[model samples]
Target: MVENKASAPGKGSLLQQTRLVCGLTLFTFVFFHFLNHALGNISLSAMNWGQDIRYVVSGKRLFPWIFYTAMILHSGLGLWKLAQRRTLKMPVWEATQIILALLIPYVLIKHIFVTRGAGELYGSNISYQHELTALWPNDALWQSALLIVVWSHGCIGLHYWLRIKRWYRRVQTPLLGVAITLPLLALTGWISAARRLELSGNQKLNVTAEQKSNLLEIVSQVQLGVYALIALVLLTLVTKYALGMFQQRISVTYLDQKTVKSVPGPTLLEISRMKGVPHMSICGGRARCSTCRTLILSGEASLSGPSKTEAQVLKRIGASANVRLACQIRPMTDIVVRPLMGHGKKMQAPGLSDRYRWGVEQPVVVMFIDLRGFTSLSEGKLPFDIVFILNRYVDGVVKTVNRNNGMVDKIMGDGVMALFAVESDMSSGARDALACIQAVSKELEKVNEDLAAHLAAPLRIAIGLHGGTAILGRIGLDGQSGVASGLTALGDVVNVASRLEGVAKEENVLAAVSMDLITAAGITPAQNLTERSVAIRGRSGPISVICLDETAIVLADFKPAS
Candidate 1:
């Protein structure tokens, strides 16, 4: 069920490669960061290699500037994108990612200033061990924070990429298990370093009593600052949540403009619920339900990618790379999307694309064929039997209409509304009208033969054909499709054709008539000997119509003007 849209450069296109690159870049950064942190526990030497690599880039003097510049630009661009969308209604996983992203810069600044700048400018001579000893109690908070951010963000991006590849679901969990377990190992290594520092008290060098006291005070102040910062961030989050409750909760708008607005910090399901959108959140937004799916139309770069939950579910659904659960995508920017099911809806809210608009032309013939005595057949038959017969009859009629280049626009029980393209020069509307009548009569005759005596006798059909410049357009209820007409039909041509077919039941004939335009278009009745004036509905005077019966009308009946 994949739909391919034209991807050539156009005014409104869905593809944007830069976003993909940005997302990939961020994910790569996180993955490497976590892998290095995890290595610290293996041995001080392994940790040294990780630091050596960082030093190669961050301390290269000439290249360090370039590295710093790139990081600033990439991180800035990612943050700027996240800020543009005014809505805060993101899934829980996404909201957490954004919070962690904001914290990363601040946390990393302390790290850089202490290790690199403090040692260079103040002559503190801070090695990784020196900094750990000075920081005291050797708390692993920074280590834990950094590890969580790197693993979660990296795995999310990987999950998203894997979803698009074949067999993503089959191996996603085992892969996820590795991603999760590695970080825990890294955390354990950091904890081990803290324990070793306690055991090796001799590692600390002699210092004055005053110097030691001052260091303890400095560490206490920094710890207090960190806790205060965490408290403030929590307060801000609570305030945002409360405000979201009062205002129309943040909603995500799709390319279709169908909104999924819900509580300020809604799970994907809640958002879908608030907006009356049909989202298949099979896992209940627990990342367990891959059914609440979405294909990101934009801002994929700003996203952190699928979380562990999303990855598992996407694997279950066998989704494409771009496809993800609605629960998984917490856009920091506006996105356009087409729900696989809701693409062709009627009366879509503003800015939503209604691709279902069928642009039919005017001055065409409209024909309606009703089966006589179909009601009686339904009265005695079972529901299934009635549907079976109805389907058979409708299929036969639809095939007949389509064979002649006419559209079987709608079917109501045993009735069918077919439209012939008046703008088409290949065939005249009159000829199409006549062909429709012949096709229906012929199809019913075949059906009567096959059914023999089991059917409700032989079905009789009455066809009403109206040919004029009729507006052939959709006539449907709200959010549905239908076929209908407007009033102006050059004279009573359509009315007469309809009335003529009405008399068909009594006359026991399948009849067709020609209008001035039909005749002008090279379509003439088989026997257009005379025009008889007949009274028609909604007209003040009698209308003259050309009647064609019994004989087959040929294209020769109409001749080109010399």
Candidate 2:
């Protein structure tokens, strides 16, 4: 028997929320630090002015506690997450983030101790002037490296956190520009300040040998502590794996009937990764995306219920009772499940709801447009010329479709697939499609006139329009924020439409529109066009269609159904 669980309303897991808040707080500090460094490009006084303002804000009694708390919590949580991973096999960006994060303490500890630690412990007044003098010519490389590593790690974290959001995609390009430019300016400013300090006599920080030695000792100890903590996490993971080897293993059966056995501790996603199975985890198993959700077919009693965070995500996506996040579920007994989303497939638009993004059967008008004789026309032309002509032709078709309220679903070489009424009723979509065909004819005329010198003859195209129920949904990379994915219609209707376009090409007519579309649009064929029952490839029965020649197409009339 399948156990059904109800979804609960919640925000997210407490650990994830805490990690995000702390990460944002630390990122704010790093952003300002880079800005302060950038001030050195103007002059040493400017850098000092900026640092003074920074100190005024961050040095407040309450602010330091917030800052230090955020720093500690953020770092600690990062380590905890790393320790939780069942497998280190991950994307390059994830690996890069981990490597850079580990390097941060080693590169930053001495700087932090010499500056903030020295100020607190030894009453040392360290200024940008002293810093520049000390860092130039010898320690500059490490300081620059520190700047890059810290900034990159912060940006990567922020990017992954925000990339799932729709609004973030709109501003990602500008944000990326800022991310790149700000660090470069800061590095330039640091070098500029250092060069200025070198021109003048190098000013050393006023510190006694004993104070310096004490700070160095503290830095060393802190570094050693970081190493120890990392080693402990690694050892714990190794120990856990060794013990798991002795534990009873459980079986997970996929939709393909392939079964894999693993220890009960790891999540289903981790098990897939461990066994070299392909699984989608767009948010890197952070419980941030619903792409990794699966439908449990059996042995539901073996799996625990969804956590609050998991339930929240499931509710947001409107998953059924048997659906569970693969990244969150750990099955203790043998179970059969199927991943809902395909691995490496793009998800629907970010703005769309799960029902629409994933899929829904709906009535839609599918149209296919293919250019005629374009391949032969391009046989002798230069590649550049061929591309130019194709672009102009495609531009005309796309514009006409959009003008008539149609969605250009896919553009293949010299062919185009469009859908109408995806958001409206079938009748309205059919009307729009009918109007689009006329508009496309007129637009192609204009395109031909414009490219008259480039073409041997006037450009021609064949169109097929069919309206019926098709599965409408978005497909593409999950969490791509709508950049690389789009809505599409799939079913027999689409296939029939494509085949009808071929019929038009074979018959040397302007279009072969299905009677289904004409009736849906409430239009009567004004011209006496021959009606034919053509058997579409891959379809069982013959479809009734009217082939419209160029003259008959220009004379076609449309009227709305009452």
Candidate 3:
């Protein structure tokens, strides 16, 4: 099939985008709701202003449907995701919030149904006063549950958004304190109003005919709304599943080693859409799911930091520095980032070995080994057979190196370089070198055993061990630095080890050694050898070289490499 080069907008990509947009809209509604509720304790007039604001909001014909649609999509997608997962292993508070969210439609159904439906039916608009009066004496347990869940969900989303910023950590405690305290204040006010009403005799008085009719009207409207949401929710469920099936996509980035892709004039959501990558913005691209997260490894200047929604979500997730929601960033220049977790192929976890595992300031031991006769062996075998043999040989060598606290660096045509103590706290380079040599010898025996049935002759490996001070930093081109730069050793020690490996191959010995500097630093070779003066390639005159005896294999014939 001819690949379609023209990148069209993907299926259900718009649904994901709509979900994000709606989620953001909902978050905005949440902010507005709380801000209005917060106004109540200050003054009744301030609370009345909330009615005016609601009037303006309701005046927009699109507002109600937009919000309702968002609620359905958000709830439906969340339900599907929850169902798909094997376990809901979230924190306790988070789990509670999820339960609360599940209960919200029921809790809220009464309010929306009664007020909006009654206003539409009886033509008697229910004002804030009418709504407030219902809860004046005290909120029901379910109402309180609604408030807690709604507020907690909003706060958790906000916290996750903020946690991505480096500065967010600094004020996280204070922010959390405020988030917790304000909700308590809202609940307290509701309880106080409820207590005062409970003490009053107004509710106990005989209800007028009009008031009784209004109450029935409100009750019936709520029932209607509940049925409506249930039907729409089911419709949404079927639609989401139907749409999701055709919405498969893959995301890609042209990020370099120290960068993430940045796009101009596009929200991260739009970019992902354009790039054909599958992402979740369950709250719409409103920074709620945080599934659209990316790490700005190198191009921070190119991208904007977290918006309010993103800021809040990051805090909840406790995301580290350098992380940001793609939806939040609008970079003018190119940036590179792996989507923290999403539908794109799991790109290899970058920088796990480079930046996080090893630092340059640490002391490390460097070892270089070249398998002698590897080139000649390759010449005699088929291309596939050569690869097979070389791979087995390299695998054995690398496993041994790793067992000794060394990371195998680049494996050349016939040689491999590795380092030890790069990640160690106590500088175990010398010990690591000793272990690597023994490992190589032991692994070689296994390789020989396996090769005995395949090849005409046994393969021999020559390893040169050296230890001392080195930068032990990642080294490569400007970009693509981490692919092979995990644990590099710089300084004279590395150079000497390479030279010594050459000497080992030339000397026809299983091992070759270095100068007194290495010996002084406590790097003992596997075998005893005579110190000989030899003219080195780069050095001035004859340099002292410790040569290990070729017969050292007899001493270590018992132990397996593993």
Candidate 4:
């Protein structure tokens, strides 16, 4: 079975944690800076007032050191990550983020040197007015692009980091609105402030020729130093790549007997991408999503033990000891493996909304309906006739479920499984399930009449309904061109519901509705209905259910309790 792991708290690597903290610190700084710039929507003095508060908060003694440290660490870690990447091929968002990040230092170094460097070295009091005037009409476009690039890169980082969180998915839409609005407002405020300064005829900063020359010389040196640092990082990566060619190579044999040889350092995922092999990595091999999990068929001893993060993910998915995240393990020896989730087809697009994709636990109403004696009815029938009748029955059931705000999860031969309340509350879901059962009975009557000549006897269906918390998610591989095959619910609730259908069939009743579902739906059981506690298979205890032979009696008479 393919296992999709949910996010869980794990003992993360120190490097990962440190990078996260540093990135958050830098993002915080940028957030406040944007807010300060947004003050330009008011007056020039308002922007200055905001800047003064910023100075007290982040521009002061220790705060400045913290900010600078975070900036350096964040940049260094980013470069380190780039150098560590075994293959450059990645999702568009990941690639875009890296490219934007690379551009940041180049675009931002001059601005930083001109503002903070000037203030520290020459005691220059640079305000919004001074900066806006210096940048407007000439360098404004570059600065605007800089704002967008920095904000986009930061937002992308935050997205990947936080998208694993369940709550983050719920609020991402509004957060997206804010993400887009803030930078635009900052730019508008900046233009407004700049225009105000232009009108006032005060665009130049007071500075001596020597100070100007000295600042320019320092800025040029800093820019060249940044360029040199970037070139050095590239050289290091190229050197590593060149050296890897001469290193002892290890082979990975896939289940299809396709073998790929790679240097010992790169993870299985990196190897797959390098060799143009399709692999699933929904979280971009970050170990947050376990789609890239593989079962070690042999040579497990040659692979390293799972990292804390990998262990946490594997445990969450309830994977066996042999299962490991392909993105995390770098095998030192030849190994044969089978990817748990099928290759490229299973890889969900990164940053895809999790509303219906990711597994989430919620209260749901599950219903299972199976046609009684379907095998007996089809015994003497031709294949075409059997298919025609089955399709008619399934079509009717599907329509009935849809009309009652329920989703038909699956159909296996003559059985139909459906879920309710996936997009609604539990109460409504329970009501929908009950209503669906009632409608299905009537719909089945029409099917019986339509195929009476072909039927041995009028068709009869047994239905079971139960309500509980279950994991709801889209399962099964994608169809052609990445169309979802189906959404399904998993857990004890679904199992119980299926078992209850068997009870209904054995008791010869139209439906067996669990008391849990009845109570949740606020429906009062009818006096004539059969009430009993039946032990479900695979479960220890008996569950109370109300069985009804006639759908009209209870369905029409019962009213939902307020």
User: How well does candidate 2 match the true structure, expressed as C-alpha RMSD?
Assistant: 11.4
Best by TM-score: 4
Task: Report lDDT (CA) for all predictions.
Answer: 0.54, 0.81, 0.59, 0.81
Instruction: Compute the lDDT for candidate 4.
Output: 0.81
Q: What TM-score does candidate 3 reach?
A: 0.37
Model 3: weakest 10-residue lDDT segment is 1-10
Q: What's each prediction's clash count?
A: 11, 3, 36, 0
Q: Rank the candidates by TM-score, best first.
A: 4, 2, 1, 3
Q: Which residue segments of model 4 deviate by more than 4 Å? A: 1-12, 28-69, 116-126, 162-182, 202-218, 344-364, 369-405, 411-416, 421-463, 467-477, 481-484, 501-534, 544-562
Residues 1-562 of candidate 3 have per-residue lDDT tens digits of 1111112111123444565466677877765666666665665456558757875976635677778888888766666544432223333444675676766776676666545655565554465455555545354676778787787777765664444332354477898887887777666654544454456543332334575467667667765775575556556645655564464332235343222232244555556654445444433344534556677665677666665666776775568978877766765655556665433442233432123222233345567888777666777678888887888888898888888777887788668898765555222455556556766887888998987876778888777765555554555431233445344666666777787777777887776655543443344433354666666567676656665544553424212222
Per-model TM against the reference: 0.37, 0.66, 0.37, 0.75
> All candidates: CA RMSD in angstroms?
19.0, 11.4, 18.8, 5.7
TM-score, candidate 4, is 0.75
In candidate 4, the residue pairs with backbone N, CA or C atoms under 3 Å apart (3 or more residues apart, or in different chains) clash, namely none
Q: Point out where model 1 deviates above 4 Å.
A: 1-33, 53-67, 123-126, 134-138, 167-171, 202-276, 279-339, 342-562
Query: lDDT score of model 2?
Result: 0.81
Better of 3 and 4 by TM-score: 4
